[model samples]
Target: MRGSVEHSWGWGHCAPSPLLLLTLLLFAAPFGLLGEKTRQLLEFDSTNVSDTAAKTPGTPYPPYSLADFSWNNITDSLDPATLSATFQGHPMNDPTRTFANGSLAFRVQAFSRSSRPAQPPRLLHTADTCQLEVALVGASPRGNRSLFGLEVATLGQGPDCPSMQEQHSIDDEYAPAIFQLDQLLWGSLPSGFAQWRPVAYSQKPGGRESALPCLASPLHPALAYPLPQSPIVRAFFGSQNNFCAFNLTFGASTGPGYWDQHYLSW
Candidate 1:
């Protein structure tokens, strides 16, 4: 009878002990936080200069200007708009780390442009574990493609972003050519009712200036929310040309932990 007892524990039958299970879960806790906390760095530089001239705009938009932001016209031939512009030092710019009201403001008339090309806009955070909540408000007269979104250039353990090059060239070998966040609009302005739609841009692909959409993964569908019409967007007109306007603001802060091991294991 003892000889007839069934036995098949040679392999693949080991059970996970309680201690082993606890250790495994502890290793996964930080990773769980990684996903929900990661934030997307929407780079606002000149390399992503508007290609169209700022003249009689409709479909073809113009490039942004540096002088508009009180900087020398560093970019040539490209004519974007800057109807009204203002800038102040960032809070971090202070050596004391004291809380100071460091902010920029602009008011664009309808059919005008508003650009911050020189002192490229930035969305800063203490850690990469975060999310971006952007609300674009349009006021005054509205123009075609009256929308606001983000442009990303992935830099993995690299230095600052490359100098913005002409529409046809680039200096940063790791530059990205595609605009990742597509919260675009193409109609008249609505009341200021737009809310922050969360998104996750996984910085996976890291190389060249063209492999954009493929480099990073788009985490959600194109955001769909009601448009806002109050606080008219300050339009920026190009060198004696067309007009366009909009404002960007971050509203909420959240921790990360949704997609850690899934896409950001590194």
Candidate 2:
């Protein structure tokens, strides 16, 4: 008589209801966020310069003269002059990260000799269209006007050369892209072929005879977001200390802190 009572739990000794299981599943569902694959295509930090970082068909180290090869942080403007740069001698897989596309990013910095006559360093193809993105992270002058950006022809002759264009004048000017940030230091680009239309340049700031707009209001031609501007199909090039010789430099650091992850498609 003492063990006659049978015991049962909340489920009445049967299976749980489907509603309960569904509720649990709803709470456990994963939030749909972009994975590394999307990051590589859209983010500046994620993009890798595989072609240049690893030895590939298009990217090749330029032949340096005398002293060539160096390294530095683009964010730190205090470092001294570097001599040369070294891209992958051959294409290699980046063990750390992978992308939707096989593209990789390699950072580099260099200095060109004015006497050499090569406005920009010859690293990648300059005879045709190529994506060119740059950031003015730090500059010697320490002002908006001081830092600059460059977009040149990836192939053929550069507009920087007089023979390329009859009235060339985009040379040695601060890139309008930098204006988007810290509006106080810089503004929008001027109204002209160089600012709106994609064209080559060949003039210096102090030496130029034309009056370009000080600020390019509205930063016309929005980047990312609603409308990503056309990919910058041009050559890669830059200068050290405004108005100096065309020193070609690329390394771990060469652009703004965000440049590595983002680039305007050309």
Candidate 3:
């Protein structure tokens, strides 16, 4: 077509180089919002690890855990039924004994229109269980953001994921299982005791009733510890090898939106 109208009238006599307009505005945005701004520059910052925990002793960080992930320019609207969870400092349904068994798991998997909107650093444990402490009790209740519309993209296919670069095969069966949350036996509970208030969230058990793997409960289990410190327990696991496999898409509201204004703007 005459070289596409002479390449748009020869670039209309030029005027666009700010590195070509910042590489055309970063290829016109959205690789899942640049992978959620590279996960807010790689998430996990529990008060900068408790303000350097007395000059780092065993600081591999991540105690009460927090990674809601919602790059709508910050949104923890605070009213999805607030309760405020706590532990070590008490009141997370306290029955004393420094918090019991502990259970509250909701980080789901189910919403597949063939995997809609998810693809960014779907990380969650694979480096020898970080500290292998079983992170006492269990809970996943904090606004329930739903891992930013979920995604378990196995960066490099499985069989212990060696090489990478396989963007979409729907899922490469939870790949390159590499988890390293550093670990100095991470344990924190200050500031309203971190998180996990409401309870009862279970799924991972493959008994074929439309499975929901790794959320919680399989006869009361949320990973255990605290019975003379020699105690142990693990309930709800279905698809081991460090379970992680995603593609639970659904996220759309870039510029002038609707879908009830991105579902009531919250």
Candidate 4:
């Protein structure tokens, strides 16, 4: 179980339905939206950790960004008019959420046209580069092109391409496969966005040196540099959504010492 990657679907023997199909790993993200205080610890309140909260799809997306918002009655991070996200599996199943007190969370592969009011939410992958604004959530909304990150797998690749490439679905308007995204990077950011000291915590570590789910470790393992991005974001890595259309890229390059894999703690 230490190094295994799970691709199972259909939550608990329930028959596959539109929502179930819509919520598969190829289409889902963990939906662990936590509440205030902890939510506002790094980013602001209200905004999801990804920081792509849009008023109307334009440059300069708004808060939850460190210097920007607050965490009051928060639920979904997607905009019903322009975007939506689905969970790939049940919350407890997301290994990424097992750290900190991110007691809850979800995973997302891509965004989609808002279809919930009329139909099940459609999972939309990029036909081309899905260029939307991005923010280092838990940081100031007006960042100096700041850095954001997540701990990834050690091998620098995953079990397959990002999702089911070219596969259409019942609740999706487009195929949700993000073919180019084979790796995720938080190379040093348990707290650091750009640079942080990597700490080897797990035995037979697979990715860029990480601790195996600490229920309560007295010593913090990672030391982030250039100051931590948002203590708030770190605390809710698994449960809080850490992405958006703006700051996210279709494909990116990982710099030196950066091992980019998708899982947070594998």
Which candidate number would show the highest TM-score if scored against the true structure? Answer: 4
Question: Could you give the C-alpha RMSD of every candidate to the true structure, in order shown?
Answer: 26.2, 26.4, 23.6, 18.6
Residue by residue across 181-259, what tens digits does model 3's lDDT show?
A: 1111101321010011011112221112211112111111112321111011011112232211222212111211112
Report the lDDT of model 3 for residue 45: 20
Residue-wise lDDT of candidate 1 within 1-266, one digit each (tens)?
A: 00000011011124233233222222222111111111121222222224332222123233222122221122221223421111111223333432132221111111111221221111121111111221112111122222112222111111221121112223322222322222321123311111111222212331221111111222222123221211111111112211122222111111221121112101
- The whole-model C-alpha lDDT of candidate 1 against the native structure comes to 0.20
Q: How accurate is candidate 3 locally (lDDT)?
A: 0.18
Candidate 2 CA-lDDT value = 0.19
Alpha carbon lDDT of each predicted model: 0.20, 0.19, 0.18, 0.22
Q: Which segments of model 3 are wrong by more than 4 Å?
A: 1-102, 106-108, 115-266
Report how far off residue 21 is in candidate 1 (Å): 32
TM-score pick, better of 2 and 4: 4
What residue runs in model 4 are displaced by over 4 Å at the alpha carbon?
Answer: 1-6, 11-15, 21-138, 141-145, 152-266
Q: What is the C-alpha lDDT profile of model 4 across 1-266, one tens digit per residue? A: 01011122212224343233333322221211111111111111221223342331123222221222222222354333333242212122323432223322222221222122221111222211111111121112222222122222111112221211122234323313211211222223211111111121222232223322111111122223122233333432432232311121111111211123222221
TM-score of each: 0.18, 0.17, 0.17, 0.22
TM-score, cand. 3 vs. native: 0.17
TM-score winner, 1 or 4 = 4
For candidate 1, report its TM-score. 0.18
When summed lDDT is taken over every stretch of 10 residues in candidate 2, the lowest stretch is 31-40
